[model samples]
Target: MSRRPADRQRARVYAWEDRHVAPHGGDLLPFTAMQPMVNAIWAELGLRYPPAVEPLPRQARRLQADANRLRLRVPEQLPSWVLLHELAHALSSTHDGASDGHGPCFMGLYLQLLERYLRLPMAQLAPSLAEAGITWDPAAKPVFLDAAPAR
Candidate 1:
């Protein structure tokens, strides 16, 4: 569960990722449409008891809060990749039974979500993680009782 290397490697691997993409496929998400998309994903992943969604205030560049809530900088732009990244944190923590880690479990679930929901190929994603010395266990995955709702 070493943090630094995995964090650096995750960034390296996703460096090509755009922060935003059209939710329905096209260019980046338009400003007016961003909040709904963000909230939608937040609710979708929150599972049966989805947490409350909050607006990120203007002053904060970062935030500290419990896993029971999702916060977004609404009315401002948000990238799809950023949304997925934060969602992975919540999903991994919830599934892995650990509060936090950038280790295999975290990145594995991150890549899983990307591959599953975004249709990114793991053939390209997994190796770069290994090459960068990130221990990624493919078994690190979230449990779904049935098909996940279409994003």
Candidate 2:
């Protein structure tokens, strides 16, 4: 089966994770654990799955146009699931009206995709979701805040 764009992108990110992130003793559990979830989601949705997994930064941002085109910036510090979640945002076509923000609907859809694709219970995923620092608020503007200054 042909690979989906999101899955291909994910694989690229995973390679980055192994090279840059893993050598530094970075934890890959979050990224490694989500594959089955993604595959499950693909099966449910009947979308083509990719071979590689990419680990996206936590503070990544995605730009979307009405035509369903997306530009993603993968953060080095972000977990792979978070990156996939943002990709999910694009795949599901959950965009706010005119403004670029992750609103309640977008977040809800993200959660639904996570559940369906990741085969994870909502409760099990909540902590990971919280760790990824994703918030759902339609009125809020999307911003890429700098990581906290190192101590």
lDDT of each: 0.52, 0.41
**Pairs of residues at least 3 apart in sequence or in different chains that clash in candidate 1:** 19-79, 20-79
Worst 10-residue lDDT window for candidate 1 reads: 64-73
Query: Taking the tens digit of each residue's C-alpha lDDT, what string does model 2 give over 35-99?
Result: 46445544565545322344454443562111121333333343444544555454444232121
lDDT of 1 by residue, 25-131 (tens): 23444556654664576566555543343555667555422231233333244455555565566655543234335556667777777776677778876765666
* Candidate 2 whole-model C-alpha lDDT, 0 to 1: 0.41
Clashes of each: 2, 14
Model 1 segments beyond 4 Å from truth?
A: 1-27, 30-46, 62-75, 94-98, 143-151
Please estimate how well model 1 matches the true structure, expressed as its whole-model Cα lDDT.
0.52
How far is 126's C-alpha from truth in model 2 (Å)? 8.8
Model 2 TM-score (2 dp): 0.34
Best by lDDT: 1
